[model samples]
Target chain A: MEIPDKSATAPDFAEPPVFAEPWHAELFAMTVHLHKQGLFSWLDWTAQLSEALAAAGKHHTLDGGDDYYAVWLDTLLQIMIAQGVTDDSSVQAMQEQWRNAYVRTPHGKPVRLADDGAD
Target chain B: MPHEHDDHNAHSLLPSEPALRVRALETILTRKGLVSAETLDEIIDVYAHKIGPHIGAKIVARAWIDSDFKQALLTNAESILGEMKLAGRQGEHVQVVENTANIHNMVVCTLCSCYPWPLLGIPPSWYKSDAYRKRAVREPRAVLAEFGITPSQTQSVRVWDSTAEMRYLVLPMMPVAAAGCDEATLARWVTRDCMVGTGIPKAPQI
Candidate 1:
């Protein structure tokens, strides 16, 4: 079955507030700025995002726009890896380090990375 | 002894997956020189305080104060906004809807979260959720009630599901007392939910 083009229909949207985390907007602007800066082309970004969306569609029912950025970040990571901007290992390393940090933090406390200790 | 440490202390931690992902992406991009730390800092500054619904409030404030602009915004948002840098990126094409004593407008992206980023920054979590997308069209009255908005029986709700190409913003009715208020003061009456058509502009403080 072909993927239904969502942009075709202009259903009346609702009053969901703009309460996304500041980081969400940060990630969004960062990507847009990079696209503008020509680190990657718009076509390239869209193609990746489309492919990501199709794959996501195959896996589960999409929660409308809820996971849009999650898919977006996935596509971005894939592209960055493909372009050799950074290696997958480095990405994994960072993820692991942060996960470790989160696993140790308490509820409502500011989670922090240990100092580089190079000092 | 310092060299023995591996970029972390035993007790320290990160807060969440998203925090990790954002930081990791930033680190990678900065390391590769694809984007500068300054660029990130500037964008973050805007995210923290400047962009998002605040821009929309400013636009609404302008509309409230200027009849011609209000007309332009209602008729052809893209054409009017095209003159300024405000209509870029996700806001390539926007159609503004007005909220009067009779009609109320709201926006959603049933397929994806296609928001007017240039004006509203990133969308709030609730706007991007499936529940709102599904229910917004089916039971707008209930949704409005959830937001503490109880429109009169004569009031009609109109939802605009934002697509990848175009988006929408609601022009909430100007409060009666807002007539003489300055732009900033008037803008304060415009909440983020008002742009989504879920809330109404409040009167200036007592």
Candidate 2:
């Protein structure tokens, strides 16, 4: 694939990237967050999820989009958080801590925290 | 202690799950030394894209639109990600790389498919290609050029080789038209391959 000139473009703010755990663990965590927030009742999430997975199964045996599902699950959690679902203290605490620790950073020039001056 | 060393040795002696799986597969191809790499590739392909990139795309999309949130994303991706609580499963060292005019960056885990599932989601197919991994560092411009991204002569292309300890995701620059768009709408323009710096965001319709 020919790489396009991204310099011609401006930066898009996708979710900031952070590395603390594995993808599936993140997926699982998001799902739990959703449940805690009550965006989707445990029963409803399981049902809709199973249905989506099942539907995905007919086309591709492996649910390759498990990460996507994790995102979908995360989206649900965000929606619930936005919608004022459960708001369990544990979930709120986690979100708060996450917000403080990982999410908030000064924009521009890629925060220099990770890069040590020395090679 | 020596006991710890011995335990480490014992653990090392035990084959990892992926190693075990590979060996099991090799056993099936025992007659032929050339095991079809495609088989393993296929499996990884399904997992990386179907599950990984899909989740990542959402994170990237959301960051593009939300300012206070975008600031949060850039400052400390891991912990902020912990808010979404989606860090850690396969990709533990997920790092975000923001693309800029003077320079362009992309990531490649040449050794393995280490990725930032919590943020960018699953990686794309070309990300795992030998051609990309081998040449990205040596000839980044050419490699990215192949993907339709041509950085200026003055622009320095830095390729971050991903490792188990450090993975990368691109905080792709937002499109000009994305000014008033909602996160979900803007996400439509953030393609998975683009997040990895292998492609550009789709042009807005006139």
- Estimate the lDDT of model 1: 0.71
All candidates' TM-scores?
Answer: 0.72, 0.48
For every candidate, give the share of true A-B contacts it also has: 0.33, 0.00
Report lDDT (Cα) of residue B122, candidate 1. Answer: 70
- How would the docking of model 2 be graded? incorrect
**lDDT score, candidate 2, position B136:** 79
True contacts kept of 2: 0.00
What stretches of model 1 exceed 4 Å from their correct place? A1-26, A39-70, A82-90, A94-119, B1-10, B15-18, B182-184
- Provide the lowest-lDDT 10-residue window in model 1 chain A: A3-12
lDDT of 1 at B176: 81
Best by lDDT: 1
* Runs in model 2 lying further than 4 Å from the true structure: A1-119, B1-50, B119-122, B203-206
* Per-model chain A TM: 0.68, 0.38
* lDDT score at residue A116, model 1, on the 0-100 scale: 34
